[model samples]
Target: MRKQQRIKKNEDFQQVFKHGTSFANRQFVVYIYPKKNQTELRLGLSVSKKLGNAVKRNEIKRYVRQAIFELQSELKANVDYVIIARAGATDLNFHETKKSLQHILRIAKCLPKVRNEVK
Candidate 1:
């Protein structure tokens, strides 16, 4: 993801945590905050030191970033999202991580609605 689309500041993360609504599954916790004037979405990730060593933490972050990248089109714009990986997340591979993230996003209502058509 681009730097512009990431939430890097401590204040930004705090704002989201304070004002956003959170949703969680076994693997991930997602906090969603709406930004009315913004045209693009931003993402923040939090992987605790308790989760693993540096290499393992970095790997988990990579999985999350890649999953978010792939789900970009499906995500709602003008919002900020913070994802916190739980202990369960470390065991997941890339595909599993993506699936877990998708599930949490759905619960958080971060994904836009799809129109189903009858053939």
Candidate 2:
């Protein structure tokens, strides 16, 4: 993700936290706040220090960033998404991290629903 596509300011984070609707699964909590007339979506990630040391935390953030990059096309524009990592997230590998993020985004209605069709 580019720097412009990230939610970097403390005020922006607080605004989203205060006004956004939240959804969660076992691994992540996602907060969504819609912005009018905006064409891009911004992402913010939070992994607590309690989860591990700096290396572990940075690894988790990397996984989350990569997952979001892959899933960007499926996500809604005109919104800010704040994702909080749960303790369970520390044990996941990259693929598992992507899956967990997908799950939470689906719950938050950020991703379009997939239809099951037998060909």
Candidate 3:
């Protein structure tokens, strides 16, 4: 995801959480909000302190980032997505994380509609 497309302000997270819809899988709790910019999608990742130590938190965030990066193009445009990491994420292997991410995306209709879009 591009730097410009990352949701940085705490207010943005608050707004998204208050107004957007949410979907969850074993690893991630995804909140998505529609926006005016049809060509941009903002992403916010939250790995709570309760989940683990700093190393574990960062590691889980890295895994989530990798999953989102791979599906950047397929992700719907003009949406603000906040991904909250669950405790389950810390123990998941790469393939398991990938599958969990995909599962939530599919449920949320956030995955690209075309098969080829999900790379």
Candidate 3, 69-104: lDDT as tens digits: 888888887899999988889899767787798889
> Can you give the TM-score per candidate against the true fold?
0.92, 0.95, 0.88
Cand. 1 TM to true fold: 0.92
Clashing pairs in 1: none
* Winning candidate number (lDDT): 2
Cα lDDT tens digits for candidate 1, 9-117? 9999999999999999998999999999999999999999999999999999999999999999988889999999999999999999998887778767777555699
* lDDT (0 to 1) per candidate: 0.92, 0.93, 0.86
Worst 10 residues of 2 by lDDT: 105-114
Which residue runs of candidate 2 sit more than 4 Å off their true CA positions? Answer: none
Q: Which model, 1 or 3, shows the larger TM-score?
A: 1
lDDT of 2 by residue, 56-83 (tens): 9999999999999999998888999999
Clashes of each: 0, 0, 0
> What residue pairs are clashing in model 2?
none
Show where candidate 3 strays beyond 4 Å.
112-119
Alpha-carbon error at 45 in model 3, in Å? 0.7
Residue 42, candidate 2: Cα error in Å is 0.5
lDDT value, residue 86 of candidate 2:
95
- Superposed Cα RMSD, model 1: 2.2
